[model samples]
Every structure is written in C-alpha cells, then in structure tokens.
Target: MSTVKMISLRVKSMKNIQKIVKTMKVVSAAKYAKAKKDLLVARPYGTSTKVFYDKLDLKDPQEQTLLIAITSDRGLCGALHKNVSTKIKEEFAKRPENSKIVCVGEKSRGLLQGQYGKSFLGVADQIGRKPPTFLDASRISNILFTTPYKYTSGKIIFNESKSVVSYLTSVVSVFTLRTLNAAPGLRVYDSLDDDLLQSYLEFSVTSLVFYALKEAAASEQSSRVNAMDQASKTAGNMISELTMVLNKTRQAAITTELIEIISGATAAKKDSGV
Candidate 1:
C-alpha cells in the first residue's frame, strides 16, 4: 500500500539526490571553465603544426598506422569515452592487422582491452585525474618514441567541445620523421637534417598530445555539466511529484478517519434514542 510515510521517505531521498546532482553540476562547471581556458591557449600551437604538415602533403609509403585514443578515467560525462572508442573501432576496421593503439585513459583501456588487447602498445591511465601539462604529454610521447613498434602514419583521437551540451569526435593526423623527410616540399629547405627532423617529430607529437588532452578535458567537463544539470532537473521533478502523492495519501487517510468517527457517533446516538 502507498502510505504517507513511504511517500515522504521517497521525497526525502529524491531531495538528497538532487542536492548531490546540483553540487556535481557546480564542480563540473568550474572544471569546464578551466579546461576551456587551457584549450584556447593550446589551439594555436596545435593548429600551426597541422597546417605545416598539410602544406608538405606528406604521405606514408607503408600501411602501418598508429592511433592515440584520448579519453578520461572518470565517467558520468555522456558519450565522451564511447565516441573515441568508436572512432578507433572504425579505424581498426580499415586496417586491422597493421594498426596499433595507445590508450590514454582507463575508460578506453577497459573498453578496447578485451578484443584489441593484442593491438595495444601501451595504456596511459589516470589522465583526467588532474589537468594535463606539457610535461605530462612529453612523458606519453617519450613512451611512444621508446617503443620498438614503428608506424608510418598516426592519429590522435579526441573529443572537440563546441558548447556545454555539444561535442564532436575529431582526429589529428601525425607522421613519422621518415615521411617528413621524404616529402618533396622539404627539398626547398636546405637547413633541415635527420637529427632536427627527429627532434621536431618528438616535439610535434608532444604538442599535439597536449592539445588533444586539453580538448578532451574540456569536452568531458562540459558533458558532465550538462549531464548533471539534466539529472538535477529530473530529480527536482521527481521530488515534486512525490510530494504531491504524499499530500494526497495523507488527506485520504484523514478523510477516512473522520468518516468512520461520524458514522460511529451517529449510530450510537440513534441507539440511545437521542
């Protein structure tokens, strides 16, 4: 039976849940602001690198490809992680055997580690626990450069935030030093050499990864803000509905008690001939 006490309890629980949701929304909003600010600063550096590569029109001769999938360890942010995983799956479909994956969060590692375990070169976990720094990106790039696996072409996959409620999964193409050296456009510059190109490659990878991390962080935070906002609103609605139900139940009980008392009093008066 639906009673006033039960309904009141449900309403109290809903209120508590709503409070938590609101708090989460506030925290996410602050995080989103910081992430967005960082992203703005990183955009120019990352874009310039991509533009330089585009002008060179470099192409890899081999089919080997590498992918750095960026995501966050924490969940509760909509499809931020799933989108990256999906993009990786699509890439794998195109080149299943010659592809390698470097997962940059626990979420991606957990998602792809099952079937793509063999394809994984490394996993970078606990990334979203704090704001990403250039040093952090350098560490990841160092790991990649040290690995025995070689790739002609590579991509960094991450979420690009548009608004608090909107985001797009994006990819940044990368190339090896060999491919850069082979570009015909590079012949115009007589000052370049193998060592310089290698250094540029390392710095380029680090910058791109740093940019991607900032973007993913911003997107994740925005997505979380939107999610928590919606959750808080839903909880508010539930609390309102539960409150109404409680009031109706309590009134019904009171009305029933009053009717029983009136009936008993009338019967007694009639029996006593009053």
Candidate 2:
C-alpha cells in the first residue's frame, strides 16, 4: 500500500509537469512559425547588401577583431545560444591581446561578460525584445559603421535556422574599409564618393544584421519546441510505467486480503467440526 501511494504521487506530479511542458512546446512552435516569416521578409535585404562588399574592399585590416554574438533574452532553447557563445569564446581565444566582444541579446551578454570582462565593445539587449525589424537592425548597423573604433574585421555568430527541426551554429564576416576597397570589382564603384561608400556599408550591414537576428530568433524557438516535445514524451512514458506499477501493487494487496479471509474461514470450520 505504501509503495502504491508513493508511485501514485509520483505519477500525479509527472502528469502535471507533462501538461506544462506540452503547453510550452505548443507556444514555442507558434513562435518558431512567426520567426520563419520574419526571416523570409529579411533575406532579400541581406542578399542585396552583399553588393557593397564586392565593390569596396578595405585595404587596411585592423590589428584587433570584433566578435558579434546574436542570442535571445529567454532561455529554454536547449544549447542554441550556448553554441554561439562557445564560438565567440573560440574566436576570442584566436585573437591577439586586443579584441572586442559585442553581445546582441541578454544571453550572450550574461555569458560573455563574466569571461571577457572589459573586452566587450557593447551589448544590445532591447533590440531583440520583440521580433527584429529593419529599423532596429539599422540602428545597430549604423553604430558599427559610425563608431570610431578601428576594428579591422567583424564576425557575427548565430544559430542559423536550416529547417523546422534543424539548425547550425554559424559565423559570417563583416567587411572593413580595407576589405571593401580590395573587392574584385572596385573599379565600378571607384567613381562613387566616400559618402556613397558609407551609405552602401550601412545598407549592407543593416540587412545582414537584421537577417542574423531573425534567424537566430527562429532557431531559438525551434530548438525549444523540439526539446519540450522530447521532455513531454519522456514524462508521459514515466507516468505510464508508474501507473502499471500502481495497478500491480493494488492487485497484490487485494489478493493478500482474500487469502487471509479464506484462512480464517477454514480454521473456523475445523473448530466447528470438533
């Protein structure tokens, strides 16, 4: 009976937990769908922005590098952001004495701040509070171009959403003044003034940044959906096993009671016959 009670309690708790996990899984799927739409809207802009990189490659590469990590404010996405953070650490390790880290979301900021200390260039938390937009991405992109920091190379690290259930932790490069100037087709845009070149850089960076943000968001939700689904299944299996145990234990208890009653009746009959 005690065993039955314990197992029953566990099964009850698991049932409630399964309910919560199932609800969370559904929410994550909805969020993932929304993020996919956002990515579709932003892809063309990112692709068109690449034209700037072709015409204006920078000649001077900076001694220090900048690492930009795209992450999210909320967790429960398994290791999606953690993978990006690990990549950031790997890139930081490769850099020489001078390098800067830029965090796009709360997760990266929290993870990197402890390890990198003062090495962080800045953190953009509020940008990803809602679904990423062109305006938001433009602000972050503008800062990178207008900032006086002489970073030669910049890399954006993110979880690329490959499909509903697949994602890749990937890194992409942002061109510097030197890289853009050395681009293969420099002669075509050579006539354009410095202002035009700056404008191009802004467009390229904004589109790329926005795309990264949306993709990372999509990856975050998708990963959570998958994880929660697996958790729910595991919980359900556990509940079913415990229920079986409870039933068997109940049957055993009832059988023992029946045996005791029959033994008492047999003894009473023997006494009466005497």
Candidate 3:
C-alpha cells in the first residue's frame, strides 16, 4: 500500500510537467505562424530586386570581394543558425585568407569569431530590428568601394566577366541597406549611366536584406515550433503512462485491502467455530 502511494505521487508530478510542456508547444506554434507569414510577405520584394539587378551591365574595377553574411542573434530555432553558419564557413574557405566579412547577427558574430577570428569586420545587431536607411547603405558602400583595405594592395585584378553592378545590387538588397541621396564612388563602372539603374540597385539590395532577415526569422520560429511540438507529444505520452500507473496503483491498494478484510473474516469464523 505504501509503495502504491509513492507511485501515485510520482504520477501526479508527471501530470504537472506534461501540462507545462503542452503550453509551451502551443506558444511556439503561434510564433511560427507569425514568422512564416512575415517571410512570405518579404519574398516578392527580394525577388523583384534580383530581377532588376540581372538587367544591369556593370563591371568591377577593383579586385577584392566583400562578402556580407546575415544570420540571427539568438538561436532556439533548431538547425537554422547552424545551416547559415555552415554555408558561410564553406564560402569563406573558398575565398582568399585575407577576405573581409561583415556580419549582421549575433550567431554570425559567434561563428565567425570562432572560425575566422580577426577577419571579421563590422557587426550590426540592430539590422533586423530596424530597416537600414539609404544613408547607412551609402556609407557601407563607400567604405567597400573606396577604402583601401590591406588585402587589396597588390596589383588589384578586376574580373570583367562578373557584373559589378549585379554584385553590388545583390549585397545591398540582401542586407536591406537604405539608399543615400548623394551616391559617392559609384561611377567606377562604365556601363552604369542611368540614374534609374542605380536607384533600382539600391532598392533591390535593401529588399534582399529584408528578405534574408525574414527567412532567418521564419527558420528560427519553425525550429522552435517543431521542438515544442515534439516536447508536447513526449509530455502527453508520459502523462498517459503515468495515468496508467496511477490507476494500477489504486487498484492494487483496493485489492490488498479487500484481501486483508476477507482473511480476517475467515479467521474470526474459524475461531468462533473452535
């Protein structure tokens, strides 16, 4: 009877844990729905920007390439962070050892610091929270185009096959950097004459950045949702098992009491007969 009581107590504690897990699962699912919606909304803007960039015929005058990899600040959303980090690492491995990195998220910061250390340059944690203005984009663009980084010193070789305009557009849109009023150091490309192309480039880059952010956010939410869902399922299963055990314990206690009562009654009857 005492053993049965202990089992019942354990079952009750398990039920409480199950309830908490179920609640968390629902919360995560709700977050996932919101994140997914945001991501879908940003996709069209990103796609349009890419299309505009594809129409441009810009050429690069400089040699070094600046790769900006975007990620998330916090990671509870499963392998989303890991996937982006892995892609960045693989890309980094293909580049020259002197390549510079501009990271956008905390996850990127941590991963880059561990992998490339000093190679990482500017890191912006607030990029996702607020969309960057054109002025900010111009500033970053100026630094990349005009500023003489240590890596590009030796006889810089320009790649004529690659469109510099497209590259710039992709980076800008993907990062969501706002366009500046007075564009500086943008005349390097001979083919870039139309003001509309330049404006489009800026817009595209900003949109791309927004899109990337949305995707990352969605990934995070999805991961959390899946994790919570699994947890909830596990909790439910545990609850069911505990309930069964509890019922069995109660039945055993009742059976033990009944047996004791029956035995005592028989003993008394025999005693009376004697």
Q: Which candidate has the highest lDDT of all?
A: 1
Worst 10 residues of 1 by lDDT: 54-63
lDDT, candidate 1, residue 102?
95
Q: Model 2, 218-243: lDDT tens per residue?
A: 88889999999999999999999889
Cα deviation at 86, candidate 1, in Å, is 1.1
The clash count for each model shown is: 0, 14, 14
Candidate 3 stretches greater than 4 Å from native: 1-21, 57-63, 126-200, 238-274
Cα lDDT tens digits for candidate 3, 168-255? 1122322111222123434443565457654654555545555655555555555656666676677778878877877887888899
TM-score of 2: 0.84
> What is the Cα-based TM-score of model 1?
0.93
Which rank order by lDDT, best down to worst?
Answer: 1, 2, 3
* Cα lDDT for residue 187, candidate 2: 72
lDDT of 1 by residue, 2-85 (tens): 988888989999999999999999998998999998888999988987787888878767688998999978998877899999
How big is the RMSD of model 1?
1.8
Error of 2 at 79 (Å): 2.0
lDDT of 3: 0.54
If both were scored by TM-score, which would come out higher, candidate 2 or candidate 3? 2
